[model samples]
Target: MPHTKFPQIIVFDVNETLLDITTLEPLFDRVFSDRRILREWFAQLILYSQTMTLSGIYIPFGDLGVGTLRMVADIHQVTIEESDIAELKERMSTMPAHPDVIPALTRLRDAGLRLVTLTNSASGASPTPMDKAGLSHFFERTFSVETTSKFKPSPETYHLVARELSVETSDLCLVACHLWDTIGAQAAGCHGAFLTRYGNAMLPAPGVPVPDLVASELTVLADQIIGRQ
Candidate 1:
């Protein structure tokens, strides 16, 4: 993090970054008889979300999830019943936080960093996945790209966060497990800390802006950020 200065605020990414999405494996196995389809479905969800954002389209994240699940079923030539879809939606909103999440967040909070969340998931829901996971109290606020009708990697989404907090993009640090997400924040003039969670890693290219910090786990990244401070 030598090239990156300490940040005034830390914005987190949810989903796989904070929550344990693997919990859906059982549902995928029950429906498709292949638990690995959970990974494909998640990739589809992210891919289509970015596709929608780039095409200047906006829809609720939940709708896209349902559509992505169906798309996966169609691709695998599997039949997903209404019950399966209902189960997917229900499980998504109840997944537990990753074991590393609380300890890492506790470390950051104890370090006195202004912690908040900026997710593609829509806000204003009474019991968001974050709230359902009992992690809502750790954040000062939860931001949704729905506020700007865009998704992550879109400059507007990052800019919306900066504007809402009355801070320059440079003063914020986005900590996310997805490279495209951290890259997006950096491109938007914010610092980035990339967490190399499962199925994700840095894209090695001359054009890609390297994250300020890279760690394989959230706890490691949290320690690095605290050590940097």
Candidate 2:
């Protein structure tokens, strides 16, 4: 493969990209008998978040998660209480980072790359996911789509990061597990690297741009970035 040019600023996507949501599997099991319900709930959550953004409706990501969980519960004919939702939210705020995250981030930082995070998470959530995961110190800044009232896969959201950093779109490279996210970044003229984590793969869409870099994990992605430099 051809080596990709290094990006001055590396933008990271949170949630499943850096942190492991599977850590909440036990909590999910309590709310529904089927293990597949967790996956469905997350899919619905992302779908609703995108729907709200496209409709010009702004809702905090946390609220969307809770609402989607209730919707999922209703669909499966499962009864869930407010307390159950609260507990899930609590666990979400403190999710653990995947094992490879810290070392990979350290490698990138050590190589003199600027690292920052962009997430669909709410603006005022205490102990933001990064803080709880003990990964906040690695980033130079943290961003949320809440400021733009749009979610990932929206051109404006990616542009907002470039504008905030006073950098041109080409100077930024988004590293994410979701194909839609990388496609959105590339659409906005930023470079992208895709991490094909569990349940994620490159979409064979003809018109969409494929990411310049693809790796199975963050560590490998870091090595690719560093090797190219």
- Across 1-229, the per-residue lDDT of candidate 2 in tens digits comes to 2324668699999999998888778877887866667788888988999999889998899899989898888888989897988788878887899999999999999999999999998666567778889999999989899889999889998888899999877888899999989988898888899999988898886787889899998999999888867
Clashing pairs in 1: none
TM-score of 2: 0.95
Q: Every model's Cα RMSD, please?
A: 1.6, 2.0
TM-score of each: 0.96, 0.95
In candidate 2, stretches whose alpha carbon ends up further than 4 angstroms from where it belongs are 1-4
Where does candidate 1 stray beyond 4 Å? 1-4
Q: Quote the lDDT for 44 in model 2.
A: 90
lDDT per prediction?
0.89, 0.88
Q: Write candidate 1's Cα lDDT for 51-159 as tens digits.
A: 9989989998989999999988899898989998899889888989998999999999999999989988877467878888889999998899999999898999989
Measured with C-alpha atoms, the lDDT of residue 159 in candidate 2 is 89
